[model samples]
Target: MAQVLFLGGLGRSGTTLVERLLGELPGICALGEVVHLWQRDLRDDERCGCGSRFSGCTFWQRVGERAFGGWANVDVDRVHTLRDGVERTRHIPRLASAAQPAAQVREYASYYSRVYAAAAEVSGAKLVVDSSKHSALAHVLRAAGDIDLRVVHVVRDARGVAYSWTKRVARPETDGADEMTRYSPGRSALLWNAHNAAFGLLARRGVPVRRIRYEEFLADPRAAIIRLADFAGLAPRPEDLEFLRPGYADLRVGHSAAGNPMRFTVGRLPLRHDDAWMRALPPAQRRLVGAMCGPMLRAYGYPLNPQEAR
Candidate 1:
């Protein structure tokens, strides 16, 4: 069975940073946001940060070879032009089930085990990182009874997440621009709340899970990295931190450049843009997010405004 590390969290919550860092670990290959199962159209014009066009990404091309047995000669331009709608609903489920069997959950585990093995072979990494960050996918992976799965539940402040969403919303048009614009602060908060809640529920049910705050991870990354290594049963190494640094340069779909300052290859790192949310977010938007996600803020150990709490 292959060792699988899942960096599960809501979008824009620093999953990419964590994924890159983990991928840096010797023998670890991290693939960014291969949420192909949820994709309605196989094509999207956006590059997946692997430096390859999504439909033509070499990493995914290899994954496709193992998954489907032969290249199949997928059309990248058509895939990019494809619209993800009704057709996706049918294909997504089939692809997901193909990766895991309903009758034999262990078969699903074996499927992922193979996937990880394939990834390791391609990237020459001992471990594989999946940054899908989807609760549903995580649930399915957990159901597979083969590999030892570790869930890294990464969280960020709701306000910060919302602010980040606002920035993305203001970006120039590209493939799936419509889908991207829909991720407002309200939506972002709901996603954060739901994802964290789902992860919490799974943890309570005895899934091998660990939670890490984006704030804490930024504040003392070495300590946080050590803790994560310990939880994953990985021996600490000097190269681990070095591997994690390059990921900060990855600016792709579902990945953010905002958190780059929090990243360091070694030694003590100072906080960067931790309070940027306060200054970046307008007073109205901040108030709205605070009011909307007050309960969640409290649950995540954030203080709600006194006036709003009442």
Candidate 2:
């Protein structure tokens, strides 16, 4: 069975840093956003975290050979069609029911199962980290029945997440021709609520869920890494985490398939909080996010008023 440590949350919630750090521990492999493996890495041929294009990355080449006889044998278009039909927020109720399979959720899930298994086999990792950051994908895997799934739900303050979504960030994995998608605070807030709620539902359904707040991690990254290592079922030895020191971590270039452009980062990576939203965000937009996020704001321990945010 495929053993997956899935990271689920809204975009810009600090998943890359956690995934990258976790890979430094023994017997764990970080796979970035495997949800985009077929389209972004296979079809478009984006850059992997190892500084090689997807086709040139020997690690992925081995995985493709192992998973589907070198990726060409797999039908990318067919998988995309199946993804649209089964792996979306609108398809959750259909996926949640163990009694139903007519929506083709199992068919789509089989593809991911193969990919995850191949990754573990190729890297010899005991657990593979998939920081897809989508609650819909998390729910799909929970209902998959064959894979062993554990979730780490990372949450950032709605105001900070709203602010991050508004800025234009470069996608180096692309040919420098496209920027990451930007979302308005109102829209980000709506997603903030929906994404967190879906992950909460996963925990209730007994999916072995753990929540990590971005603010908490920024405050004490070393402690958080130890906690996360334990959660992923790697009761890490002190030497396994030697790369980590207070306020900084020595990172390695990864062979991740897809994720935030930060996946391309290497060397001494500093861990710090980005509260740019506090100083630069217009008060009006912050309040709008606070209002739209509703009780999910408090559920994750953020104040209803942005000014009162920690």
Q: Can you write out model 1's per-residue Cα lDDT over 18-124, one digit (the tens) per residue?
A: 76555545556665554442132143334444333445566756765765463354443333333132112233344343544454334433445566666666666
**How many residue pairs in model 2 have overlapping backbones?**
0
TM-score of each: 0.71, 0.96
Q: Report, for every candidate in turn, its global Cα lDDT versus the true structure.
A: 0.59, 0.86
TM-score of 2: 0.96
lDDT of 2 at 267: 91
Query: Where does model 2 exceed 4 Å of error?
Result: none
> Tens-digit lDDT track for model 2 on 1-310?
8789999899999998889988888899899999999989888999999989999999999988998888999898999888888778776655655555654677777888888899999999999999999888887776566688999999999889999999999899876789999999999888888888888887877789999999998898878988987887778888888898877889887988888888888898888888889988899998898788867878777877666764
Best by lDDT: 2
Q: Alpha carbon lDDT of residue 55, candidate 2?
A: 93
